[model samples]
Target: MRDVSLLAGVSRMTVTRVFIRPDHVLPETRERVQRAVLELGYVPDRAAGSLATQRSGFVGLVLPTLSNGNFAAMVEGLTEALRTAGYELLIGYTSYSVAEEERQVHTVLSRRPEALVLAASAHSATMRRQVAQACIPVVEVAELPDDPIGHVIGFSNYAIGRAAGDFLAGLGHKRIAAIGASSDGERRDLRGEARLHGFTDALLAAKLPADMVRMEGDIPFSFTEGARIMARLLDEAAPPDAVFAVSDLAAVGVLMECRRRNIDVPHDMSLLGFGDFEIGQQMVPALSTIAVDFDDLGRRTGELVAELLQHDDPSGIARTDVGFTLIPRGTTRASVP
Candidate 1:
């Protein structure tokens, strides 16, 4: 800044304003400062500037994984929204562990983000307390927890599972099954478990057996795990006529494995999945999926964050439920015989 200001024949404060609030400077002066900045390759030290402004100019986002397309899309949308609001996004991945989630939350909080956002809301009590004490607005995305720690912009994972179950059950397929991640250990996907529970509830409510509902596997499960789990289901003496995977990643795996085994899908078995991934659309039998507008959810959450940061006083707690849709494609037939 000092070098650029000297070259531009302006004070250090003028250089600062050029980057922080270019609109405040005259067009000719701003153009000169920008040229100097470019020539010197000067980079603004945001950390130092943040001390003077007392605004970090960034929001924190925690996610289960970065590999998922839906998650990537959501983050892209979130970053776009935040960028338009003059903020950046700092992200951390927890790999589906509650402990890691707590650690990442603490790490991001220490950075003094204007707000915090979590992709999933299975927060530990300690984590929740820390977030509350951070004195910043918080948003829980992709889930509507029974007890939200802060503002929520998400749909119900349980409802998604129930909808999947109801749709499959309504197809006259008496023998139905589901596969999802088990939350028995600390490294868990609690949202997936909630979906499984909802699926179970739907099955029981319809007087259908929930025995075929297999709750086993781990996070980041796609083709290998999906195929592995599906193989187990196929070995059963009475294999299900239809199956639902908590994630489309797993559903794709199941579809590929079925193709390998020469089993006709929706003929010998029907399949459904969640997360409406692009890969599902390109699949041969184009997977049927429970779709959530995750990217839109991220954008909405970003807008909400910007809105929350505007007021000094804590505003009313807001909860937004972005619902899900069940998209039936070639993989799910209208009926099973």
Candidate 2:
């Protein structure tokens, strides 16, 4: 800052004001300081500045995986929302592990973010304690938990699962099945598991056998695994006429596998998936699946955070349920009259 002031022919206070309160500084002076900063490649350290202001001006966001486009969209919306409030996002991915999430929380907290937002509500005991001790606002997004640590802004994953099951069943498909990750290791997708349970209950309610719901796959399920799982599903003695994938990526994989095996979709078999991903919409036969407004969810979460931070006394524990929608495209069949 001292060197920037020297280069801009201004006092250190003028340089500081240019970065902190540019509106208070003259336009020409602001331009000079900005030019000096650019030439020196200088970036202000919010963490250091927070020592005086007590405002870190950044929020920590924890995500499960970057591989999913839906998560990416959420992050994009969140960043944009935060930008207007003069806050930035410090992002981290946990690869669907509670332990990793705890580690990430610790690392992010070290930087002293004003708030923390988690994509998943489930956390390790240590992580919960740590977050509580930090005394910062916490926001849980993507999945609404029964007991949230702080504010909740997301749809019910279980309801999405149930909706998928009900959609397929309503189409007159009696033999139904679902594919998602098995809770085999410490790494898990709790949201996917919730969907599976919801789907199971929905099937049982309709008096359809829920035994075919196969929860066996890896975390962050992919297109390749979807195809492989679909192949195995077809080899069963009593194959299900309809299948629900935990992800749209997997559904596309299933469609590809069906084509390879000369199976006609919505005729010989019907497919459904969660997440209304772009590729699913662009497929030869558009995918049928559950859709959540993840981008909107992120934007809302960010807005909530900004609102909380701006006020000295925030309102009560807020809960916003954006809900889910079931979209039936070419991949799913409706019962004939």
Report the number of the highest-TM-score candidate.
1
Error of 2 at 83 (Å): 1.5
Query: What is the model-wide C-alpha lDDT for candidate 1?
Result: 0.89
TM-score of 1: 0.95
Which segments of candidate 2 are over 4 A away from where they belong?
6-10, 23-29, 45-47
Residues 179-235 of candidate 1: C-alpha lDDT, one tens digit per residue: 987665778887888899999999999999999888777676677788999999888
TM-score of each: 0.95, 0.94
Q: Write the per-residue lDDT of candidate 2 for residues 1-337, one digit (tens) a residue.
A: 8889999999999987876667899999999999999999998886677887777778999999988998998998899899877789999999998889999999999889999999865788999999999999999999888988999999888898888888888888888999988765788888988999999999999999998888788777889879989999888898888999999998899999999999999788999998999999999799988898888988888899999988868979998999988888999877722
The root-mean-square deviation over C-alpha atoms between each candidate and the true structure, in angstroms, is 1.6, 1.9
CA deviation > 4 Å runs, candidate 1: 26-28
Q: Report the error of model 1 at residue 317, Å.
A: 1.3
